[model samples]
Target: MIQRAETEHSKELGCAKHLLLAIGSANVIGVSLPASLSSHAGPGAGQGRSVFFSDGVSRIRLTLDENSPVLIENSGETAVLTFDGPGGLISVEGFVEKTGCHCPKQAYITINEGCIFSCRYCNVPNLDKHIKTPDEIASLISDAVRRENVECISLTSGVVGTMQEEDERLFAILERVRPFGLPIGVSVYPTPGLSQRLFELGVSEVKFNLETATGKLFAEMCPSLDRDVLCNALKEAVGIFGKNRVYTNIILGLGESKAEMKQCITHCLENGVIPIIRPLTPSAQLSHFSRPLAEDILSISEFLQSELLRFGLDPSASKTMCAKCMGCDLTPMTDLHLGEVTP
Candidate 1:
């Protein structure tokens, strides 16, 4: 019985690795015939027009007949299928308002959809800009909670004009949704004294993405921001939000070597911030870099899982955001409590 269970667990992990590869690949392996998605739950239950998929052990909500950045291929009746996307498969409950952000576990919303910075890998500036009012977004939060089982909320926005202006808007939205009691995570540019300010505003989590792992890569991929400023801000974040509560996103395919990746992860661990390693998802004009190899992410994830444990940090202990979501990457923090992965 023990041997059988071990074999089963290995099979599941192997399948997960394959899924990660498909999800993290940049080029499409095959074209899928388009189909129309019909709701299969609630008012649309029993309708064959919808399909469900599980990323690792996480149940994902998906529409059958639509084109998502994450594409499903060779789908069988059991929904045991492979999905392709630059980023690993995430729990996309659906779009919020009209931004490209995916609400994996709970809610991922964009305060506005235009960026002022010119990051080499982001296509946000190439698209049409969108803005939302505080009340409109508050209504969105209410609807998301009412209509869906949205547990927490993550917010992102382009640098509308100035960092201060964007911060004001974010604070306003927080005021409107503060009464909901949902754990809120915000991803924004770090301004002077902003972490403490946001922390005081009841923001539960925050991410200021140092997308590139090293200063050299930062200059090559994203020259708009000062790398030192972001790094300094992360230290402040750890001080204010505590370890593992503060986070940053590091995309894997931006010319960062394994050594660079290790250094980056170590830096984050040393500073008490959890680095969310992401694949360089291709889209818009930013589709040049190849998708990261899944094995690389898996290797790093295994290291990070151990690193987190070493630091007395636990992703599962996080209150909100990507560590809690664990959808976009192969981080093993999501798998620590499982029953030996028997299934």
Candidate 2:
């Protein structure tokens, strides 16, 4: 009986990795953050603040929302995360990680806080626009590096103007921070010749989000953006950046079936681009959509892990962005271990 009980506990630990991801993809917390954590000024202030929760083995990022079923309470040195599961109330132990800027050990900065294209599901297009000057960008990165000991720098932006204008603006910012001697990554709406230009700028990695599993949904959700251009950009990125250095986001719960999601993952892997299976964050614009179930997330992520191994791609090899952070999704190598968890 003792041996049987030990086996059950071991299986639960294996599932625990997926369980943590489901909680993160749900992106909610039931309790108000204690003053110790809330006082820290970080990203997504206008929206809800986010918390990084790490079990000793893996970490997941969750947003603070009183409406969620999950509750986190501080213990002596760690926090107890409790939630009502199908069986009963389940509790897990971990601690809240203080990130360097937007994520741990990286200065993830946004160049433009607003977008010109009105993607119905995204909130950035509706937010008040703010473009950071080059000097301001340098100062922010400098501060994060000094205070947080950041190892990499990541830059993302909403398209606030013409594609050319945005690219030029990014180039200017890149020039200012080049001397910092940290690996840099950029995520932007791709333009012709953008990948080569970025490689010439000494960028270590690049990401262009496909953001949808199928072309039909892509057209419906992001009507103004061309899916073909995005696909070509991703392929081109793999060529310039080489394998394991290029990444893209194939967001889940956007009305895509499992087969479609797998096909999308296959396309990315075939081209040597690492795909991020990000869960949809519900918002006023996308109120009709719901977050994907934890089971669905785990199953799909398991498929991703297998395919990644088949293709010889490694998420751990990425130098920047969501792949490096592993906060927002079920990252393959870092979070999903194959038969390695033990009770």
Q: What is the TM-score of each candidate against the true structure?
A: 0.76, 0.87
lDDT of each: 0.62, 0.76
Q: Model 2 — TM-score against the truth?
A: 0.87
- The top-ranked prediction according to lDDT is 2
Quote the positional error of residue 186 for candidate 1 in Å: 1.1
Displacement of residue 101 (Cα, Å) in model 1 is 8.0
Question: On a 0 to 1 TM-score scale, where does candidate 1 land against the true structure?
Answer: 0.76
Taking every candidate in turn, the Cα RMSD to the unseen true structure, in Å, is: 8.8, 5.3
Among these predictions, the greatest TM-score belongs to: 2
Error of 2 at 235 (Å): 0.8
Model 2 per-residue lDDT at 271: 94
lDDT (tens digit, per residue) of candidate 2 on 133-237? 999989988878777769899999888888889999999999998999999999889999999999999899998989899999999889999999999999988
